[model samples]
Target: MKKFIATLLAFGLVATLGACGAKESETTNPPAATGETGATDTTETTELQTIKVAATPVPHAEILNACVDMMAEKGYKLEVTEYSDYIIPNTAVEDGEEDANFFQHTPYLDQFNTDNGTHLVSVAKIHYEPMGIYPGKSASIEEVPDGGTVAVPNDVTNEARALQLLAAQGLIEIDPEAGLNATPKDITSNPKNLEFTELEAAMLPNTVEEFDLNVINSNFAMAAGLNPATDALASEGADSEGAQTYANVLVVKEGNEDNEAVKALIECLTSDETRAFIEETYGGAVVPVF
Candidate 1:
């Protein structure tokens, strides 16, 4: 009877120890996951977009440079490529090699698109650089000798602007129908009987001294160390229709007008800060139209 009780007690002790071991295993080792795979939830990070623009070296690139930090703050990068000629910038944008361009006005852009068969559009009109009649051999309009030559830009849009400036100064009269697309053929009356020399817009500055007076684009005039606000014998007034019509604009490919990067650029360009910069930098040679 005593042996039987001791054996039973030993069996009970073994079972208790086994149960405790099983409990500890459950607490420490846990059950192996059955037919289940672990998964990690992750989010993708998006990279910022870069905007590339073609621009003239003067006020356009300089103005874009000022907006670089502002764009970066808004999570974008602005890359400005300087272009000396007018043709390549529009072509670059049309070909998608550049995101936008900033060297031309609406009329010039319209003419370019029509002539090149490219679908480019303006996103914003930023500023205007008045077309000025700068004296070369002649100091004033009154001093221009009869039949003296007056140089003008050979391009269609700029030639019209030059004619308009001449008309404004009473040196000549343009047909009312010629409007912004006028040429020498559109001239109705020439009081001075001045001869017109049509040359490339960029060449006007260099040839200014050769002609009695040269109609100079403000950018080229500034590049030649002439101030349109001061040195010009006659310039388009701020309130003039020409000033409103010839304001330089931000341009992009037609379908990309609403692109986020382009939108950001337009915002930066038209901001009050940019306006102030134009006023301070060019000293009214370039007037903010935004």
Candidate 2:
């Protein structure tokens, strides 16, 4: 009887050891991935798409900077390259060095493509910086003496725009057929007999003091401490044909019109926030065309 009881006790001890070992094994090595662990492991991460854009310094870069946060929210990152000259932006886009540019108008783009044989297109019309006639030696158009020297941009498109602005104010009459491509030779009427001196668009600001009146592009005018809204002797009105025709545009390489990243950029630029920012910041010097 004593031996039987001892045997029974030994058996009970072995069973307890086995149960503890099993419990430890369960703790150390979890069961193969069950549905519980595997089902909850579905965290997803989205990668942001990056787009590079070239722009002018003042309003274009400022406007693009404002949209950075808004774009990031949409899974896109905007990288802006500021260019002071108008030529490089388009060339950069054409060469694929930049994804898009924001410093030119449709007419200028058309002329550039024609001139350089680059394939570029406008993605969206952003703003209009009205060409303005600013005072140099003369305070007003009527005050200018006959045969007064007026400075204009040498670039084909902008010189044409400058002439058009003068024509709009009755200072001159451009050949109706010449239209946006008009040159000084296209002038059919010049009651003031104003002599046009064509210079680099960027040089017009510094040379303004030398001429009787200067037809300055709004961007250059603003850069030279002149305000198109107030300092300009005369400016293109928001409703003027020039304003509608020369609205500065967002441009891209021809085939990138439907690019997803470019589309996101356009959406941010044309957003209500961007419109309000332009209206408030530039006060009328830069008009939002939507």
Candidate 3:
């Protein structure tokens, strides 16, 4: 009987040892269940990089800011710096302080690049701000009396566009040789003998009451609560050369055209939400080119 009790106690001791071994194994190498390591939950795995850009306040920055969520999905952050003047934004991008800029059109960019010797190039044409003729004194092109003064943007390219739109309405005629660069000097026929007043583009809206008619850019017009589609006496054709060639663009230093971040921003800007925002917010003042 004593021998039998000894064997039973030995078996109990072995069983206890086995249980301890199993507990150690479990503690040392625990099994991964749902939502454990090596799973597809990206909560702690993926992080996004940030991309900075410079833009004008009126629409460029606002448009870009609208794409934040879209860009985030692609693992990028869009930081937009609003610039008041035209020169600083491009300069900032050229100096690598900004990844890109979206304020100027292709023609303006081309001219700026030529003038400043900057190596900037347009990657995508996003939208165009239509040039419109607004009424202050004259309700229509025909109503303007002879020798009445018309206010136009004093810039070379903008003035040309204004003159072209006026010519399209048959209110005046310009020299065919002048092309997009048409100026007051290019006006060959002026039956009304109306005088043209040149003013800074940004100030055109504020000084609208000072002139019989104001040829204003879409941005300034919008700020002045004038909708180009509904309020303008006349506007540039939607398919005009100015609309296409001067379409606002995403610009970067020439060599960075193929940059991954810049390409992603282009994709985001041309996205559905961005297009919808431009159409709805600008109310046809800004047309998407993509």
Candidate 4:
């Protein structure tokens, strides 16, 4: 079967009043009514609140950028700060330096919380970017010789995701019960005896040429101008176990998931406007779950 490069988008809220094709409700002002002082009763407009979010440069930051103006219209200033690596974004949220973050999936977040004892949690499922095995030195899967080196993400969850993708290609075999956290040690069979090299997920795209094949997360592939749909020798699919387990999420410190700004941000992110943006900007590379 031909594998797919998964795309992802988020889901939340009932409707939006402005932007991204979310139309405002039509209303007519009632004839002016005078109060005891013969003055019209007026409602005070709520002040705009600014919320900080951390994201990766490619689709995460780009996707969030599409919602900035729409968020502002909804009484929130959506400030997105871009980070190249995975660690700081979560740490920043844990330390209360960022209001929330976008760019990672639930499994990564769960592992980070367990590994670091941080209090981050996912509030909404956004999109899923399928991991893909992109060519480094080898041009195609069949061309990868025995003893080939495959660079993979070092982080526990992602590394397992990469290994699983490779296993699906019949390039390797791993212990079946190891599941999402499986690693190279779980490989029960290596038909080609491919060597695995672990690296931080962000570094794979920049250094892909140094290896035989690199398992790259779609977001980084996108940033490096590698479209997994076209460039990958093999890729994960939407219906794959990883996709159902790894939809990118909007993460926040556990206690603050219900903040007003966070709620509005969720509304804008999952709004029709954002769904359209994901579809147009990323094509099939960033599929919207909503």
Best by lDDT: 1
Write down the lDDT of every candidate, Cα atoms only.
0.90, 0.89, 0.86, 0.89
Pairwise lDDT winner, candidates 2 and 3 = 2
Predicted structure 3, TM vs. truth: 0.83
Candidate 4 per-residue lDDT, tens place, 1-290, comes to 12322221112222231343433222334335466566565666687789999999989999899999999898888999999999999999999999999999988988889999999989998888988999989988899999999999999999999999999999998899998989999999998989999999999999988999999999999999999788888888889999889999999998998999999999988999999999898878888997
Q: How many clashing residue pairs are found in candidate 1?
A: 0
- Candidate RMSDs in order: 9.3, 6.4, 4.6, 20.9
Candidate 2 has a TM-score of 0.83
How far out, in Å, is residue 54 in model 2? 0.5
- State the TM-score for model 4: 0.83
Rate residue 10 of model 1 by lDDT: 100
lDDT of 1 by residue, 16-40 (tens): 9999999998778655556556633
Ranking under lDDT, best-scoring first?
1, 4, 2, 3
- Candidate 1: pairs in clash: none
TM-score to true structure, per model: 0.82, 0.83, 0.83, 0.83
